[model samples]
Target: MGRMGLFRDAPQGVAAVASSILACIVLGTLLERFGPGNVHSGLPTFGAIWVVTAAASCAPWNYALTRFFICRTGATFVTLDANQFTCSLMVVLNVIGTATAEATEWGNLGHGVTQILSILVLSEITIHSGMAADTAWRVSLIVPAVFCLVTATGLKLLRRNTSTAARLDVSVTGKITKSLLWDSFEVLKDFRVVVRIMLYSTSIRTELAMNNQLTTRFRTYFLMDAADVSVLAGSFGLLNLVPYLCVHYVDVLCPGHLG
Candidate 1:
């Protein structure tokens, strides 16, 4: 946030992060205290807490990254196009790998293939190269951490040569102010933004709900095993590529027609 000028007042960003961490710590402590026995027993129990805490820790930096990119692009569509293209491409590749795994009955091998495609992590290759699972997992995280460090360094270098105004800085309190809240409600008074938000929210929520229910539905209705369910899941991702591609090309061909 300091780097990207996300906050007009830099201390506001620092305070926001501090507050988030305090909240997460409170929540995690409660969970740890009164949660179920099984929750207290596993890697995931602590891992889940760590993930939330980590996100809180990284919030400012991630916001800085997003703000930097948005500024760099100058137009929202360029960022959207790039993000959607990358997301779609990863989904398509992962789905392809999953399909191949199903066809070949490679079990966990298939899963690792799709994981690599989705995350661009070479942990699978490391595992195959005789690295232990725990070691491979640790090493896999290091790759992204290193990449982020490099990317941030590059951005800092580039930013040194560019002159741009810092955008409107909204603090946590300012964003939640009574007047701002009312303003948000007023803004939603615009039918176009409301309609888009509603439609997108509805579709995304429905798809996510269906995705969550799918494995059970496949097991009950089709008697498919976990592996088969994975293959079926991948098919939806594969199908999404068509519409994603269409959206990309439409934006390219039509320019600001839709906008």
Candidate 2:
């Protein structure tokens, strides 16, 4: 199918869901075969490392590439909607995964499974469902090289006709000179922008850094095991959905304001 069919209105929701299911199946099989305490005796050390490495390597660039496509096409509302939708899905899945883990033998492994699935789904969408020519060439080469080594024909499946690069103004419109550095310095001299940047950076860093510490503290201070910590963390994820919902509604209610 086409990119529009896969991605739908805001982003690649359908493709993401499909990829998540497929990843879950693949990971589940691997886990059953090589996970600790599973049917097989081998540890999934390599598999875990591969997943984390792939995710960490591709994640930032994936977001940037997606945003580049959307913003170049002037789909600002679509970008906002996509963020809200993805965040909401994360919150819901986190809760469900946590609850399932707590009630079953999965423990924190359940959370890890869903997270891995999400990462794989995101990678799939970023590489395949994105407008082909608009996607970063490095990303395009890397994804198929990694995932389609066995199939070899998978690169042919990526959409070719759809590329946002055509719509984007990639040309340099202004004269390039050493004064560009001075221009940046001039902008940075604005006290209001400086304060805003600082505040935004601080909050973002705090949020990112807190997750590991929070999980660790849950296990250490509260004497919670993996399952208990998962439950607590998932509860926070569920709470996070409230803000995403509100953000969505704000866009709907106010149209061009918040979005």
Candidate 3:
């Protein structure tokens, strides 16, 4: 079956329902696998590494696509921004949040959930499932390498898209700079905005560094059984978000809890 269009006004229920089903799966993975599947052996290890790599990389790709599609393109800004914020949000959350949680206890769990959902769905959408992983893995390596290529392509195609809603209202009558490394301090309109962005970046880096080791560290230090670790991880994830999803008013009020 064909997937839903990017711009179609999917009922809020769809996103919510989809998000719920995803929660069950992630927590279930934790419950079933226990402590990141055994990789001490051969084929299992290969598959386990594949899973790990996928876990490491797929999430970022997924987030990027979502942001590109939803927020960046603004859900098919075929005429407007063409930015696809959804696609961008995925990458931002995944990069800043998922891949390098090298710093924390619950490390990347929050961002992990978001990336998993965005990528899995996008994978299933753009590429067929059987082919998605292979395609993703190939694309995963040297993400930074193809990063510009893909972004450039997206931008080029977007300009051609009559449906795009261009976010940058400013007319570019001048020459375009090929340079990517620009100073953030120079770009910021105000010092306060600069401070906010800096503080925000610092807080995220701090959280990821300090409280991100929920899986690896726990598994090592406690020497817990695989099942035990999985159960613990699952329990934490479940308690972290599941119950709130079950609540109506509570979730609507505190959106972060559901995430």
Question: In terms of lDDT, which candidate is strongest?
Answer: 1
lDDT of 3 by residue, 142-199 (tens): 3422332454445444432112332221123142543222322244777786685586
Instruction: Give residue 31's lDDT in candidate 2 (0 to 100).
Output: 26
Give lDDT per model, in order. Answer: 0.37, 0.35, 0.33
Give candidate 1's whole-model lDDT: 0.37
Error at 41, model 2, angstroms: 34
Ranking by TM-score: 1, 2, 3
Candidate 2, residue 244: the lDDT equals: 41
Q: What is the C-alpha RMSD of each candidate to the true structure, in Å?
A: 17.8, 20.4, 19.5
Stretches of candidate 1 exceeding 4 Å from the true structure: 1-47, 50-179, 255-259
**Candidate with more favorable, higher TM-score: 1 or 2:** 1
- Per-candidate TM vs. native? 0.35, 0.33, 0.29
* Candidate 2 per-residue lDDT over residues 1-259, each given as its tens digit: 1222312232433333333334332432342223212211111222223333332333444433333322221111111122311122223442433322232222223333433333354456565767452343334334423432322222223312113321212133243433222343465788986795586357433442343245556755788654556556555434444444454355445644655
Q: lDDT value for candidate 3?
A: 0.33
lDDT for 76 in candidate 1 is 14
Model 2 residue 175 CA deviation in Å:
8.9
lDDT for each residue of candidate 1 in 140-198, tens digit (9 for 90 to 100): 55444444345444433432211122221223214443222234356667899678668
